[model samples]
Target: RASLPSGFRHLPGHFDRPAQEALVAELRQVITEAPLFTPVMPRTGKPFSVRMSNCGPLGWVSDLRGYRYQPLHPVTGRPWPAMPAVLTALWTELAPDAPPPEACLINFYTGDARMGLHQDRDEDTFDAPVVSVSLGDSALFRIGGQKRNDPTLSVRLASGDVALLGGAARLAFHGIDRLYPGTSTLLRDGGRINLTLRRVTRAA
Candidate 1:
């Protein structure tokens, strides 16, 4: 287990093969129901680099108008798939300081896909941490401070890896530089799937 700079926690290969396989199966079923789609950037209307969808009570959405959380899939107009129990358990274990995540954003990254540096600030609550699980191929995760241009650090996230960004680093600017193709033999073919759990709404 490697402790990331900027106080982020990197639990490498935390999930065993059985657990990873189970999570993948759950994700496949969720995708079959909800499907993955490219979200557009707010204002620009340009599609996001990474194809994404979600499960849980709410899902993250971005468009020409702006970014926000919605209860339904934009394409299907149906409620997003329910968050798998394994994910909920993992979140509880990894981020005990945070409340139960209200949204789980599943991002599908092909060999060429990449995410730009950005902070996750859509959630109303900042007291919780963000739990991210990586499956399939490896990816270069760039972690920086709260400021956009602060010095950053890079880490190779592999299958079954979990990264916890919480406490002071909860709002740190981070993104995926690029994915290392063909790293994991577990993926259906070859791709990276990242599940990020966050509390998008306040509990009433």
Candidate 2:
């Protein structure tokens, strides 16, 4: 595989179409159990364009109270659905040195929906890397350095592609600029789904 900057690993077409479909089907069940909820911006209360849910023990949420991880769904008040073994296995294969992930954030995106550049810093430990899998459609993913003004790299993350943020790149700023509709057949609808595996607690 070609090398990227330190701590940044991009594996194109990491999962085949069949695997993507299988994962999507599994996520369907997760959505049924946990359901998707709109995450709000802290203080502003502005809702994000994407709807999200989680698998594993802790889930990330944002509302008037603020952005934080909780044991239960903000609305349903139930624990998050267990993460599928496919995801857990992927994480173990990709980040063997890190502890098992406790959270798998699922993001559903549609046309015109985009995530602004931000750092994933809420987790307690930096020892573990974040493993993100892209399914359905394609997204223009942006990556910048730790500083806000640093140079950035734009990569098209298509269905089945995976990216890992570890080491110095773990705290790098990143986000999805936009989605290219009709780019992939993984999702019957012209939208995208992103699965991110994270370790919320400090490594023991």
Candidate 3:
């Protein structure tokens, strides 16, 4: 893999096949408790192609009003499922210096779904790195400098891969350009699941 921007770490095959499978099983249970729901653009009210859910103490949500992190599910009005131990363990291993993660946003992307390049600025603090785990189908992950128009580069992120955006790349613009379906059998059906762990608030 080519050199990525500073503070950007990509660990390909970070989780072995068995580990990925176990994580998938855990996520299935998470979905049962926190059903996936479609998020909409704040003003246009157009739904995002990817469906979303969350775990941990807080969840990231976007709707007609705007994007923000809250303690409960927008649709269920109940607190999100607790973050899986596997995920919290990963955070402890990878981001030991940062505060424990409080939000794990789960994004489910089907074929033809794509996310435009954007910055993750909803959090109140940028001190902790944004840790992401990729599963199932491979994706073309595009990343660039903090500015939206900065020269961008794309990388193929396969299942079990883990990416960390911190320091200089913490506020970088990034997104999934497209998916290479059938690349991995992690998911029964062909699709991709992205688990993004973020520290939503500043540590005391």
The number of the candidate with the highest lDDT is 3
Candidate 3 per-residue C-alpha lDDT over 95-140 given as tens digits, one digit per residue, 9 for 90 to 100? 9999999999999999989998999999999999999999999999
Q: Which candidate, 2 or 3, has the higher lDDT?
A: 3
TM-score of each model, paired residue for residue: 0.95, 0.97, 0.98
Q: Write the per-residue lDDT of candidate 2 for residues 137-159, one digit (tens) a residue.
A: 99999888888777888889999
Q: Whose lDDT is higher: candidate 1's or candidate 3's? A: 3
Q: Put the candidates in lDDT order, highest first.
A: 3, 2, 1
The C-alpha lDDT values of all candidates are 0.89, 0.91, 0.95
Task: Write down the worst ten-residue block by lDDT for model 1.
Answer: 1-10
Writing each residue's lDDT as its tens digit, candidate 1 over 73-184 gives 9999999989999999999887776678999999999968999999999889878788899999999998878889888888899999998887878888899999999888
lDDT of model 2 at residue 62? 82
Q: Model 1 — TM-score against the truth? A: 0.95
Inter-residue clash pairs, candidate 3: none
- Report the number of the highest-TM-score candidate: 3
Which ten-residue region of model 2 has the weakest summed lDDT? 1-10
Q: Which of candidates 1 and 3 reaches a greater TM-score?
A: 3
